[model samples]
Target: MKSITLFLCLFTYFSASAQESCMTVENIKALDAQWEEKNLNPDPEFFKRVLADDFVWVHNHASMIDTKTSTVKRAEKQAANEGSDTRSRIQSEVKVAITGNTAIVTGFTIVDRGPTPTRYHFMRTYVEVNGTCFLTGNHTMAIPEGE
Candidate 1:
């Protein structure tokens, strides 16, 4: 009876942990979608809410935008320059590991493709602050032309 009870408790704990991990993945996916929409529409308020105040965006070209305000402004400017058709379709595979209230998400983002299709792979890290998730940093690597 003692062994059975212990096994049940351990199973329950592991099940709950797995559920939490799944939730974290879902949250990351939602975050990615929100960012994509923000980039497309260029809403500073939405961008601000999604990203941490001290968020920093490191472009694949080595240009970096530090601060959420600057990042949003930059996104707005880029959207304006590209017109309404500005679409950044990201193929992100998120892996989230949670520790207490914080989770680390690592993923690749593939951006901007026309009829011919060109893509860039970026390794991004996200940190959760006060129950809100924000992109902390990133390092991008160019994939092969065919890939």
Candidate 2:
């Protein structure tokens, strides 16, 4: 009877731990904002911290694809040029979903850096490992003018 009781207690504890490990929407939203900030500012350290080693990003209707290394390199290059980036981004219609240790965030963003505003629909995937969240995948599609 004591062995059975011990097994039950262990099972319950593990179950609760699993539930606690799942990422919440609020958590993912905050993380998503960090991603947007990275885009706006192109900070290499922030990208390094949030992006997984094998992260992949499909940018703007497959115009280009970038890996974690490439993304960091691009940020470094951008950072080298002083006062070049003047982009401002606004995110809307954002939604987040989570399954166990993984989260998916979808949103629309309008960026004003050129003569006119460019809009995009984007999705980001994040995974929690050892209680830390890392961006694993990203895909974005540009919305054409007037629609």
Candidate 3:
């Protein structure tokens, strides 16, 4: 029937459009890099854009999880530090997974943790809000010293 044919066409069109709207690897990387750059430069406003109200972060070296408020306050305080070593990181093996409006970014990063450099594998999850990605979870594992 014409009704059945029209239904099929509509379904196909919608399905294809939905698939096209899903996040791509380059899009994920660009959005994530924006947040990273803001953080590296120590901007408190970065938290406003990239974090949800319920954001939480698990520090690799900390015994406690950080809440959005706590993390923002800490970054604000750190922004005032003068003459301190500027931190840098080298990232690799990055991967992104998207599910509906949620995305998970996983990667390995080499950071100067102390007097020596260290590698860590990290996972961060985000949800798209108003077409902008907002981080909701974070975890990182340090790679072994020799490996």
> lDDT of each prediction vs. the true structure?
0.64, 0.88, 0.76
Best by lDDT: 2
Q: Return whichever of 1 and 3 wins on lDDT.
A: 3
Candidate 2 lDDT, 1-147, residue by residue in tens: 999999999999988886674378988898898788777888899889999999999998688999999999988888887423657989999999888889999989898889888999999999999878899999999899989
Question: Which has the better TM-score: candidate 1, or candidate 3?
Answer: 3
Question: RMSD, model 1, all Cα superposed?
Answer: 7.7
Candidate 3 similarity to native, TM-score: 0.75
Off by over 4 Å in 3: 1-22, 82-86
Residue 125, candidate 2: how far off, in angstroms? Answer: 0.5
Residues 1-147 of candidate 3 have per-residue lDDT tens digits of: 999999999999988866563266678777666655655566777877678899888877666798889878867877787312547667788889998888899998777747888787888888876556678998878888987
TM-score preference between candidates 2 and 3, better one: 2
Ranking by TM-score: 2, 3, 1
- Using lDDT as the measure, name the better of candidate 1 and candidate 2: 2
Write down the TM-score of every candidate.
0.62, 0.82, 0.75
Instruction: Supply candidate 2's per-residue lDDT for 50.
Output: 91
Per lDDT, what order, best first?
2, 3, 1
